[model samples]
Target: MSQTTIQISQELQQELNRMKLFSRETYEEVIWNIIEDTKELSNEAKRDIAKARKEIAEGKAVTLSDLREKYKIQ
Candidate 1:
């Protein structure tokens, strides 16, 4: 297969490295694995996500991280 080169920031590269499941997993495999996971979410969950995004765009929702911090979750 033909291959391509893309540039990513050092921080992003480190995050990708941290996501690797094994020493031999390639970047393509890692990206496709994430894509597969998003495709696996249920229709109800997907609709809820769409609704949440719309709410956030309307400035009507608190992000989970912010809510977690507000609740003092570790």
Candidate 2:
């Protein structure tokens, strides 16, 4: 890989270092993990997920056989 140089404050460097799981992890990995973890879902998507989860938790989910029996589908 081609190498490039960038500069960050010592405080930022320390924060990145603290975020690392191991002493040998690269700053690139640390920054990428922070980036991936910071992803946000839309409000609508979040609401749908919450609703689906609640249905499953409340035993409101149905199997194909249950639906077939309920509707008496042949």
Clashing residue pairs in candidate 1 are none
TM-score of every model versus the real structure: 0.52, 0.56
What tens-digit string does per-residue lDDT give for candidate 2 at 1-74?
Answer: 99798999999999999999999999999999998888897799899999999999999999899989999996
- C-alpha displacement of 38 in model 2, angstroms? 1.7
Model 1: runs farther than 4 Å from truth? Answer: 40-74
Record all residue pairs in model 2 with backbone atoms less than 3 Å apart, i.e. clashing. none
C-alpha-based local distance difference test score of model 2: 0.94
